[model samples]
Target: MTSVTPGVPERQAARPASMPVRCPSQVCDLDVLPDGVVVTDATGVVTAVNSRALAILGADRDAVLGADARVALPLQDLEGRSWWTCADPYGGLATRTRISETLLALPGDREVFLTATLGRERPRGPVVQVVVVLRAAAARRRAEQKTSALISTVAHELRSPLTSVKGFTSTLLRRWDRFSDDQKRLMLETIESDTDRITRLVAELLDVSRIDSGRLELRRQPVDLPRIVERHVEGLVASGHAADRFVLQVQEPLPEVWADPDRVEQVVANLMENALRHGAGVVTVAIAGSPGQDFLLVRVSDEGEGIPEESYPMVFTRFWHSTRRGGTGLGLYVVRGLVQAHGGTISVGRAPCGGAEFCFTLPAGAPEHVA
Candidate 1:
């Protein structure tokens, strides 16, 4: 799902087989860090530099450790202004603490962002040392670009539905007596559907923010997942799908799950919608519980052209839809988040009918269920 927000350690440098891998903290283990670190004295003289910092700054360790901080690490903002000259950690206000993370350019086109933690004896006191934490800015910049694209796309998507709703309502209001009952009903129904779309888009934005911020929470309750699926199937039929196109297979005596009802329905709705919209033929939903009733598994498949194996990984990522339209493209991402929040996993594969199949699971609930 686009709105749903969501790693490994760096490999150590190869060492001689006989050499020990121990990092002695007493001698300062800063060299083992993946992030660049540079520590300077109050006078802005470099006191210590890590191997990562040397690599990032492209400066020799011997030349940098005892050299002037400004001379050792020449950094400038986009406008070519010196970073140290602007920061002035020692000359700035006594109350000033750490320098916030900033993007700066080095010689050539290399870019790095760093933040300095100011060590102080007391508030508004003289600075002791500036501990600058540094990292390559390429990944962060890429993330910013993606965020901007998603925001632009979401805004564009929201506009279309809102414009339709406004147009329909305004027309109906201006010519109320000119329309027949059936026509008016149709217009109102269209508006209602558009309104639902707008609501879902807004909810997706909020869910994405929450998921990204690690604040997305589940209102746990005993959920009849199969019933939820059945209700969604009914909704699909009501929305104009043929009844026979959908087949619901529930392994009776299935266990209930502890999940949020809205989230549970959202997962089902997204999958069923994808099956109908992207895949061809009949849609089949199969539900069963794992051994020991620890978790419940739901598999949704279609009789259409299944997703290619290569695109399987991209299916659950934000805005991954290459051809599909009329969606924020965040459904599967949000579904993945919801499923994962319940300590479960979701996967994609070819179905028995040669169509795409999505399978997800949820943890079992307690006997004293809410609903």
Candidate 2:
């Protein structure tokens, strides 16, 4: 590896026990820093190196101590000069400067792109200390790339629903007198469905933001599990899905759940919607509770091709999609967030019918009073 600082002296002074040594300047403890830290004396000899710095250099603490700082990190500026040489023009002033896009050539021909910040402590003192902080260049680039991709995906997903709503409403408005009552109803329903799709997409996006920021909100209350599942199935039927398509099997005298009713409905609805769109055969919603159990179990299963076992781990990841069409890929992610927010757990597996089964548990609430 290329060495940036000058050769180490034969007899080096004893290194200080603490960083910044007795200087009046405030100094951050290198040991507590998350990033790699390398501290050097005025003559450019490695005096102190943190554990993280040793890991980055692939060397032991003893190997780097008393060595030339330049050889350990081997940082070179864009102009092909040692970083220390480039900073030498500053004449030992106490200043903090960042060297962007610097190349660090390590042993074994491995190179890492880094941005190094160079700071001096007590520049005018008899003994000046230089501190260098290093960060990976690829990390910042990856974050920028992810942000760009999310924006593009959101815009693309929003366009289709917006176009459908606009077209259906415009046609209904202009050709109102020519349509029959049935035709008018169908058009209005189609528009409403498209509008709902838009709303769902927007809500999923917002939920993702909230989940990422650890700010997801849940209004918890005593919820009747059977009633919520039945209502969701009824709504699906009213939306033109066959009533027979859904099968709800609930154990008698099931306990109430302590959860958010609206969020519970959303979880069931998203799962059933997934089944209808991607699964085949009967979609069954089953609820049961054991006498000694503290939680109620709800399972939504379908009789279609089940997800591969290896893919189960990624099913709940944000923006993950099995197919190109349908969904903003946030339904299951948001569902998991909402469920966990209420102190519940959700999982996916193969149903008895050889298809996807989503099972979740909710904490049981107090017994209901029959008045």
Candidate 3:
């Protein structure tokens, strides 16, 4: 399905023709389409059916080609009603020249996405032809499942923190003098921390939206990569992580790369958090310039059982889940989008210590004004 950007209205003009081509001959040999195509005559007889259509419906070519489409098609709704009888393209209103895409079940609990064009001789005239398009439902179904998962995950994750915030605030207001100063301070601090978590989750959702919609914007400035890494590590250590658990190294004479400072810091924090949460033992982060000409590099690695090489492709996909704890799985996706927006590339590999490794490079980009 095509996403129409918000605030952009579709043009209003004369009635538009369906599917760019209408005749039976034009769509007959349309095995060229990655999707299945089926055409029917005015009397509702199946005139042409492509190989894909046969494969999807599990119908024999000889049996399907000449049969009445109403009987030949094996699709049914959730109520087990025949699709043709319910839709009734031939008997439906002449103004309805097409069927919007709909999901219908086939035999054996399988499903297909179907859309059709009802061709007529003139405006509101008798239906002369019908062109049907079929597509496997797997990809669309997976996308819908992911969207549902995202909503469920975000709701579940937000509920805990929000409940804590409300509970703490209510307790404080109700028993202001009963608690000691230290106890009150701890309650307020907890509230603050939970608020930060909520803020971060909302920010991540917005970033994911922007990245997917091709609307992500960067405010490029010369970034001090080492300082950001140092500060992030310091915070982690202060937050009860062992100081020795992280080995940080920054090579001097780093190349000048203009990038969004906050985004770069977000990238660093996400990688470090991922390493800490998912991997075990020592975590190492190194920022350096390449030896020869210097491609600005940031490498983060951990000493844990390395990720399987086969899993690399899925690491950055939206809503991808792992056995590891925490995060909405948008961190690495946002990290990659931020890196690429700066004209950079990121890769996953295995570390020397037999653990997952992530390396990203910035191509020493200048500001847009200079470019």
Candidate 4:
């Protein structure tokens, strides 16, 4: 542990026996703070240091407490000037000034870019303490990067559907008299399909916002799992997916599930669509009652190349797509959110057919009474 400089007041000596110290807020407890905190006297001699500060500095609490703030922190401005000299701490300037473009060099050869704010605890007191708060610059940069990527992705996804709709509509309007009935019908269908695609993309974006704000809601009711699965398969076929490509298997006398019917359908549809787009061979949807359990287990499996074990944890994260052209990168994230809202657990694994398998369990409805 780094040792604090000598001549500083000990923890007991800092406070008078007559006066008790009280924390004004939970943040006053330095241990719970996410950012590093260091307190120094007006002359820049360290008086107190938080655990986070010690960890960030890679020094011991005792070593930092009495040390000069400049030696312990050694911050440098963007122009390579010492932050302590430039800031002029001992001058009559207020301690509340924000320090920007500062770099802190740790003892272990690691450096952290940071922004700091300095404030005084007692402005007119004889022994004033300057409080410094440190925030990591790298974290902010990462957040900015993610925001830029999301904007780019949204623009790209929206442009494709909009282009298709515009091109089809323009062609039909210009060549309406020359087109036969079949050609007009085909163009109209294409436009409608493109419109549906745009709607789905917008809906997924809204769901993501709702999930982030903790406002995702579910209306739970008794739902027939097998029926929902069968209906989704049929809908896929109607949307041009080959009917023979899907296989549905339901265990005999399976109990109805306690879930939101619409959300359950959404989950099944998303998983089926993912399988159709990414997997090879027949896609299988299976539902079975868990023996001696109150949940019904459902699995959507495909015979395409299986997902790597390392990638399983990230599959359900928002904006993460396995392929460059995958839809919106929000399908699995929304599916997981809906399943969890219904008191269910979902997981991904290798199927028996050597491909990706998504398994989820939903609460079973009340059991029927025997006559």
Candidate 5:
């Protein structure tokens, strides 16, 4: 996690400890607040500085009060330019102007940004005071930047190879006279493989985008749960996923539930893919109803290294991969989102199969949907 800079105070000549003080209003009690509070009169004069502010800035409160705010505490914009003369809500030129709606990068590795706001009214009141509020800016820009970069990189990297494969396949099919039957078969196989790779990449990208945008619309209809699980098993085994290496034990005549048929297949497929790649021994995919349950339960379990107990909560988070190989980190995230979109929940934990088990719920009745 990147650290955010805290607000800064100004460097000025120190005042003697015995400076006379006057309280402007009850709000002046803000100096006692835990946060490093600083107040400036409408004239830009430091009306009061809290003890916390003094400690944070390494200055005496008596020395800071009655001083020019810009002199006691300096501020800068993102470009490293001084913002002393920025916009002010009050109409006073000499008053130590209060800074509002601004971020002050302090001298430490703090992740929380300090935001100041006007606490005192001007003109009708003292026209010379302002209040500041400090809070952590939970903004996440790095992940957004990384995702954008990944989309661009993946598009460019895959386009050339896919184009070449498609071109050769088209040429061979069009000019069948130039190649023997064996040559044609080989080229076709290459074409099929390339097409499959492109398809997988496209599908993954689509799912990730839909999940990020929160626009993954589901078409829920009553469907047999067992049929969906069985279909995925048959397809995976026929597709050479070591059919005999793992056991897919599922309950028969599973409860019929409402869910998107196609999206459900994608969810099950992604889970099985995870199990096959990360798990050892038998990878079990099971579907059973919760005891006296109003929802249908589905679980995909693997006998691989089970996730550390500490990492269980993070498994469903976007781009959180346990291992460094053959994982997009988006599969479980999208899966959870899709399940929740259908008014359900998901959990990951130790499975009886000995690896990791992902269990999800599908509401037996219609539930509230989110956009």
Candidate 6:
């Protein structure tokens, strides 16, 4: 057999301490550790404990010491069962086998959690003592409840706009012949614009889920950078902005970029939409070619009221809007993600046109031949 270490004692020789340290008179004297600690004897009688334990149990040291420890700190199993079958599920004092356990409050009216372990001095002896640590469980539960409420509120708010767009589109499509050519075109335009708005909102919702799940995917393809820019701007114009309201400045003989075509379109569209919403008169879409750099630099500028210098960096963050306009505030968030997927960068700043400017970069290369 191996020899025992100097500090180690055999189970047969270990005995419980009958005496406990009397807590000081100072009510402010609490233990350094957040958890309240309690030391008990082998027979489960209370011995020594910190002031935190005293406050946790709402009892004086004289009233607790030498009493059955289980009367102050009880033990519970995983299923929350008590030592006796008739005990209240939460009322009985019980130490949990696991590190995290929720228990009922004493007279203090605050929920308490007890974490305990069996401490032994000898291998063969009964657990000579059980040390129980206490913490309040109410704070964590409150935080979780608040987060659940926020999610429910956001979901309910989003459903209204989506329902409006869906109902109008379905109604128009079902009775196409009942409308005149001009009416038909107007209804079609409304349906198309509303559908775009709905799509953007749904995409934003999915982007949030993708970010949480780590499943954002970008499809890289050979795309004509300038052509995509012009197309997106034109489509956005059809949505609201007139053709003459925005100007395009793309260098001739533009290079094809290695990018996700649809995502790239989303980036350009979001920037242009932001410009139209925040800017005053003219919005310029500029594409400059960087020959040796293997990237195409693009800038979307508007002549509206510029953003404050301090708010520049926050524009791309999720649900950030500096203005009072009715927007879901996810446009720039989606833009940044799409730009990053192409291994590109995007930034916002004051535009020379007295508005806000959004700039981004993408790879510049000739279209690759497909099989």
The root-mean-square deviation over C-alpha atoms between each candidate and the true structure, in angstroms, is 10.3, 5.5, 8.5, 5.8, 8.5, 10.9
Ranking the candidates on TM-score from highest down gives 1, 3, 4, 2, 5, 6
lDDT of 2 by residue, 231-340 (tens): 98888899799989989898877776767789888898899989888888999999998676678888999998978899899999766776535667778999899888
Q: Candidate 1: deviation at residue 356, Å?
A: 0.6
> Where in model 6 is the C-alpha error above 4 Å?
1-97, 101-159, 162-196, 252-256, 290-292, 363-371
What is the TM-score (0 to 1) of candidate 3?
0.80
Give candidate 4 misplaced runs (Cα > 4 Å). Answer: 1-29, 85-127, 171-181, 252-256, 323-325, 365-371
Give a tens-digit lDDT track for model 3, residues 243-352.
Answer: 99998888888888888899999998998888888898999998899886346999999998878888899888876655665778788889999888888899999999
lDDT of 6 by residue, 224-271 (tens): 767887787678777676789878897865666777788888788778
Q: Candidates' lDDT values, in order? A: 0.81, 0.74, 0.83, 0.76, 0.67, 0.67
Highest lDDT among the candidates is held by which one?
A: 3
Write down the RMSD of candidate 6 (Cα, Å): 10.9
Residue 210 of model 4, lDDT score: 85
lDDT of 4 by residue, 50-110 (tens): 7877877778887887678878887666556665667654343443455564565444545
How big is the positional error of residue 316 in model 2, measured in Å on the Cα after superposition?
0.8
> Model 2 Cα displacement at 169 (Å)?
5.7
Worst 10 residues of 6 by lDDT: 83-92
The runs of at least 3 residues in candidate 2 whose Cα sits more than 4 Å from the true structure, single-residue gaps closed, are 1-33, 77-82, 87-127, 137-142, 166-190, 365-371
lDDT of 5 by residue, 159-223 (tens): 86689797887798689899988988888887788787777777777887887788888887777
Model 5 accuracy (lDDT, Cα): 0.67
Looking at model 3, report the run of 10 residues with the lowest lDDT sum.
3-12
What TM-score does model 2 achieve against the real structure? 0.78
